[model samples]
Target: MTNHYYRDFLIRNWQERDRIPAAEVIRSVLSEYGLGWEPNGADKDVLQVEEYYLATGGEFWVIEYQNQLVGTGAYYPIKRSEKAVEIRKMYLLSSVRGFGLGKYLLQQLEAAIASRGFLSIWIETASVLAEAVKLYESNGYMPATGVETTRCDRVYVKSLMTNFY
Candidate 1:
């Protein structure tokens, strides 16, 4: 239950009421990119944020622009390595794109991860998500393999041990 303000947007922890709207925002963004929304599959976590994220020692956030939910992002620990986390569900509506909020959200996520003593961060995204790829690369995430999600084709990893935070 934390709140972060950036310009006109408010980034805060996910709540029960945000489930539907946040799912809609994510589904809509995936649709805009011609990708399918896998509710029972890859995206089941969106329906059970508490169980998948909050309860599992991870964090989920919803982005509000003018009091409207416009984006979502989350991360949870994974068994891939020691003290590692995978960034998930980072989608922003087109209306909110190009405003650097995505980058800001990413920085916030990274700072939180680093502060929590996480040593590694991983991300998976599709190649069609060109903007996402550019953002990750620009933020020091090097290309990697072994993507675990069906919707993603590209993988990136970053070590939070240095120059991170």
Candidate 2:
């Protein structure tokens, strides 16, 4: 068995073989966040959203250990009056928890956004995703008032003042 900790995981652009495993990891994480998937209903919606993100200029960074995908972080431009981008889906398989990978992924995403001259990065997450909420908070994102979704999603925004590249 691969030791996830000792293995070198590369974070790179998404590929075709990554689709299914990435979807599965995200589905599992969403379930843990109380956003359970239903094959014929919400699950389909989730998949469609993923497809839409890919169709746009969205980029997915997949983490692999010994050729096995274990997590993903994606970002796409969101329609806004000001230059901004959104951090869409981000997930790490259970085995990689507590390894600082989340922070690493966020940093990369932020750098990519900033490099594009976007002034801010925004993200939304259901309230049940406490860990995600904390991650955003710790990374300088501030809560913003917005129309809540059926899933009680909360919006957070982080301003990127300088180019990180």
Candidate 3:
């Protein structure tokens, strides 16, 4: 899950010990966007990245900058006939906002999915997450036709067939 380093940043696969710190990174970023963190909610998946992401024929990645877990991103398998994955938990601390790390993470995630032979990627995001929406759109994620409720109001999709991983 490594990408050419972003400054001193290194991307690595999510490990069991990263659970708490990774959740902190995610929660921190969400908080900046005025999003509330409710542990009792469905976001409990953030606390169990292994079971919901890694163990589900998918993967989660953490980016370390200066030995600190500053960013987190993950893609997990979903019930789609075309070998699809959902990009989830993509967030970064405000300190790393303009360093091109988000783009790198998106690139790496798509490569990881394509490496595993997945055909497409799907993502859901709230309308309030303008930066995230821009990142997704710039990374080739277009509007998805599916109807999704219960969480995000915007859904996006991108096909990862160019390099075939």
Best by lDDT: 1
lDDT of each prediction vs. the true structure? 0.93, 0.73, 0.82
Residue-level error in angstroms, candidate 2, position 122: 0.7
Cα RMSD for candidates in order: 1.4, 4.6, 2.2
Task: Arrange candidates, best lDDT first.
Answer: 1, 3, 2
Q: How does each model score on TM-score?
A: 0.96, 0.81, 0.89
Q: For candidate 3, lDDT tens digit of each residue in 1-165?
A: 655577788888888889899889977877887877756664788887767886788788888888899988888888754788988888889898888888888888887888888988999888788988999888788897664534578989888775544
Question: lDDT score of model 1?
Answer: 0.93
Please name the candidate that would achieve the greatest TM-score relative to the true structure.
Answer: 1
Q: Which ten residues in a row are the worst by lDDT in model 1?
A: 156-165
Which whole-number lDDT from 0 to 100 does residue 124 have in model 3?
Answer: 89
For model 1, residues 73-162, the per-residue Cα lDDT tens digits are 999998887999999999999999998999999999998888888999999899998999999999999999898888789999999888
lDDT by residue for model 2 (90-146), tens: 888778878888887888788777776888888877777777888999999988877
Which clashing pairs does model 2 show? none
